[model samples]
Target: MTTAPTVRTSTPEERFVAAFELHEGHTLNGSNARIQGLRKDAIESFKQLGLPGRKDEAWKYTNIEKALRHEYRVLAGAPLDEVALENLAPFLVPGLEAHRVVLVNGRFVAALSHIGSLPEGVIVTGFAKASEAHADLVNTHFTRYADFTTDVFAALNTAFAQDGLFVYVPKNVIVETPIQVINLTTGDEDVLLNPRSLVVVEQSGSLKLVEGTHTLTEAKIFTNAVSEFFVGPNARVDHYLVEDEGANASRIHNLKAHQEADSYFSTSTITLSGDLVRNDLHFLPDAENCETHLFGLFLGKGRMHIDNHTLVDHAKPNCYSNELFKGVLDDASTGVFNGKVFVRPDAQQTNAYQSNKTIVLTEQAQMFSKPELEIYADDVKCSHGATTGQLEREAIFYLRSRGLTEERARTLLLLAFARDVLEQIKIDALREHLDARIAARFAN
Candidate 1:
C-alpha cells in the first residue's frame, strides 16, 4: 500500500496570536473594554482560520499559499510625510475636490488627508477613532452584517483591523461630494496590510464613494482588505474601486453589502495592475423593492492573475439585480470570473441578470468564466451568460489600414470595448479620472 507523504505545517498559529497581542495593548482611547474584547475575538478567530488554501472553494481559482508564503514584517509606526503623498499624487482624480481619507500600510494617516466640510449629520472618520468618539454606532454596525464564518479572509481582516475608515450618513442627508480613500502601500518592507472600511447609509440617505489603491515601494507585499456596506431603507449608494498596484504584490479584497427595503446599491470596480488579485463581492437584498448594479473591468499583462467572484442573493420579493464583468488578458496572464445569483423560495417576482465577457489579446493568455443562476421561486426572471474569445482581428486590421498605428488601433479598440462598462459609473469626475488612467495604462 502506498502512503501519502506527510505534509509539514508552515507556521504556528501562536506566532500570529503573539503578534496581535502586542498590538492590542495600544488601546484606542475612546473605546470601552467590551469593544476591545470584540476586536480581540476577531483576531483570535483569524489566527485559528489562518490563510485559506486551494482546497477552499472561494480560493480555489487564486491560490494564496503560493502567492504569499513569506512572513510579512509588521510595519513600524510613522506619520504621513511629503514623500508618501507624492508617491500617491498620480492616483488622485484630476479636477474633483474630493474628501480624501488616507491610510498608509493599513494605518490611518490624518496629515495626508483632506477632510471636506461634511453634511450636518454625516460622520466620516477612522474606525478606531469612531469607536472612541461614537462607540454606540461603531459597536452596532462594525461586524453586524457580514458572515465571518464562511469567509476566512474576512475573519482575518476583522482580527487584524486596528485602523480603517468609517462613514455614516444619517437619514435624509445627501452628500453631493464623493468620499475618496487612497490606500497607499510602501513596499520598502514586507508587511501585511489589513484594511477595513465600514459604511452605513441610514434610511433615505445617499452617498457616493471612491476607493483607490496604489503601491509606492518596489518590494513585495501582501494586502488583505475587507469592506462592509449597509444600505438602509430608501437609501442609495454608488461606490467605485480602482486598483493599480505594483506587479509583485498580492491582494485579497472582500466587499459585503446589505440592502434594506426600497434601497439601491451600485458598484463599479476597475483593476488595471497586480501580480495576483482576488475580489469577492456579495450583495444581499434582504427586503423588498431593493435594486443592485455590479460592474467590473480587469486588464492584465505579463503573467498577472485576476479573479472576481460575485454573488447576489434575493431573499425578498420584487428585488432586481444586474451584473456585468469584462476582462482583457494580454501576454501570459490569466483571468477568472465566477458569478452566482440565488433567488430564495420566498423571493417571488425577483429579477436578476449576469454576464461575463473576456478578450484574450495573446495566444498564451487564458480566461475562465462561469455564470450561474439558482432560482427556487416559481415566478422569477433570472438569466446568466459568459464568453471568452480573442480580439477581433478584422476590426484591428481595418483600423490599421485607416492610417492608425497597430498599437494605437489596438488600444482604441480595447478602450471602446471597456467603455461600455466604464460608462455605467454615475460619478463624472471619477469616470474621467479612471478613463485617463486606462488610457495611460495602454499608452505604455
Candidate 2:
C-alpha cells in the first residue's frame, strides 16, 4: 500500500494565505456591505482554520497538504484570446438547445457566452453582473447555503469568490431550456482558480442546470470550486456536474444544498478525469416530505486519484433519500468513496438508502469504499453498503468468444457496469455526449 506524501514545506500555503489576507480589504468594499462583512468574516474563519491536511477526518484520505506544496500562480482577470477557444471544440455538447455561460481562468467572458431567450423572472447572469444588477438576490442567498465555518476549502473559495454563474427562478416559473455553465481554465504557469456559483429556486419553480469544467491549456492547475443550492417548498431541480479537466490539474468541488418541505432535489457528479480530485457533497432534508437523490461516477487512469465524500442529513420527519456512486480505476489510479447518512432524533420515518460499487482492473489500481448510516430515530429505514471488485472474468471471456477483441470486451463490460447510473441522467444529448467520452476513455 502506498502512503500519502509528507509536506516538505509550508511556504506555498503561506503565500496563498497572504494573498487571501490581502484580498479581504478589496472584497469588503462592495455596494452591499453585508456581503462584504460576510466575506470578512469568512476570511477570518479561514485564517483560523488554515488549509486541511491528513489530520482532518473528512480529508484523511486526500493528501491536500502535499498537493499544495508546489508553487501556483493565481490569475486575476487574466487575458484570454477569443480565438484560443477553437481547441475546445471536442468538449461541447451538440444537439442541445441551451443557454451557455463561459468562464476563462475563473473569470466571466461575455463575448464567448450565448445568452438565449430566457423568460422573465429567470435571472441568468455572471456573478459580478448579477451581484450589481440583482443585489437583493445576491445579498439574500449568495453565501447562505454552504457552511464555510467547518470547511476550509469552501472558506477559501468564498474568500476568493469573484466570478461564476448565478441562476435564480422565481415562484411559479419554469425554465424553458437547460442552462449550461462552462468553466475553462488556461494559463502559462501553474495556477490556482476558484469558481463559485449560487442557485435558488423559489416555491413551485423548476429548472435543470449543467455545470462543466474544461481545461484549455497544459499548465498545471488547481481548482477549488464551490456551489450552493436552496430548494424552496415544492420546488424541483436537476443538477449535473461534469468534470473533464485536462490531465495536469487538481480539483476540489463542494456542493451544499438544503431542501424544504415537499421539495424534490437531485444531483449527479460525473468525473471523467483529473490528477487529484475531491468532491464534498452534502444534502440537508430540513423539512418534512422531501425527496432527495445523489449519484456519482468516477473513472481514473494513470496515477490519478479521485474521492467522493457525501453526507445526507435527515433533520426533519418523513423524508426520503437515495444515493449511489460507482467507479472504475486502472493504471495505478486510486479511487475512494465515503458516504454517510445521518437521521437525527426528530427525523423519524425517514427512508434513506446508500450504496457504493467500484471496479479496479489492475492490481496497481486501488479502490477504497466506505458507506455508513447513523440513525438516532426509531422509525427510520436507512441502509448503506459498499462493494469493490475486478471486471467479471466470465463476462469478458463470453464477449471474447463472440468475436470481440480483449480491449473491446473489457470496454463493453465496463460500460455495462456504469450504464445503470448513466441512464439516470435525463438529458438525452448529455447522455450521448457522455457515452462518447467514455468510449474515448477506454479506446486508449
Best by TM-score: 2
Tens digits of per-residue lDDT for model 1, 1-444 = 113554534552454565566666563222565666766677667766777778977677787776655666443333433445576678788877778898777767778888779999899888778777888887778777666655667776666676788999999999989999888887466677777888999999999999888888777778888888999999999999998889977888789999999999999889989888899899999999999999999998999999999999899999999999999998999999999999999999999999999999889999988888988999998889998987688998999999999889888988888988999988888788788778877767
Q: What are the per-residue Cα lDDT tens digits for candidate 2 across 1-444? A: 113665545565577777766655554245466666676677777787887777987778888877877667554445654535565476679987788888777777777788777878798877777788898888888777787787878777877777778889999888868898888887667878877788999998999998888887788899988888989999999988898888888899889898989999999899988899999998998999999999898998889999999999999999999998999988999998999999999999999999899998899998878898999999988888999998888999999999999999988888888877888899999988888778777767
Query: TM-scores of the models, in the given order?
Result: 0.92, 0.94
lDDT of 1: 0.83
Q: What's the number of clashes in each of the models? A: 3, 0
lDDT of 2 at 317: 98
RMSD of each: 4.3, 3.3
Residue 106 error for model 1, in Å? Answer: 2.0
Which parts of model 1 are misplaced by more than 4 Å? 1-9, 12-15, 26-30, 47-50, 74-85, 401-403
Name the best candidate (by lDDT): 2
